[model samples]
Target: MSRIVFLEERCKGCRLCVEACPAHILRPSGRFNHQGYEIMEMDGQCTGCASCAVMCPDTAIRVFRSVKIRNTAGEGAA
Candidate 1:
């Protein structure tokens, strides 16, 4: 699983993230931000590919990938 963070205040609501997301997980908010632009947020379907992050001109979005842990005992048993 991965974590997606959206910085609404910094967003310009240009829909660039939504358009760049390959999974189509990002959506426009119904309410506008202080800048009067519709905010963009990631939904549950996000794959964490960072496509949106790369496309965002304002650099308001961040994607964090979860680290996988391996059991040392299991490796010894193998």
Candidate 2:
């Protein structure tokens, strides 16, 4: 699983991240932040692709990827 964090105060409500997200999980919050701009919110699963972070002009988005560990001994390998 992936996690996305947004610095709402730094966002300018440009919607660039929203359009850049391939997962289509980003959307406007319909409310303004401290800067009086409509902040972005996540509404779905995040793939940790960093599309939104890369597209964000204000660098308000952050993506964290989960690392999965598999048990090799669980299979018939021995």
Best by lDDT: 2
Q: In each prediction, how many residue pairs overlap at the backbone (N, C-alpha, C within less than 3 A)?
A: 0, 0
Candidate 2 per-residue C-alpha lDDT over 4-48 given as tens digits, one digit per residue, 9 for 90 to 100: 999988999999999999989999989899889999999998999
Structure candidate 1, residue pairs in collision = none
Cα shift from native, residue 67, model 2 (Å): 1.1
How many Å off is the CA of 15 in candidate 1? 0.8
Considering every candidate listed, which one attains the maximal TM-score?
2
Structure candidate 2, residue pairs in collision: none
lDDT of 1 by residue, 1-78 (tens): 887888878889888888888888889878778988888776776677898899989999999987778767756564
Model 2 root mean square deviation, Cα atoms: 1.9
For each candidate, give its TM-score against the true structure.
Answer: 0.81, 0.87
Q: Give the TM-score of candidate 2.
A: 0.87
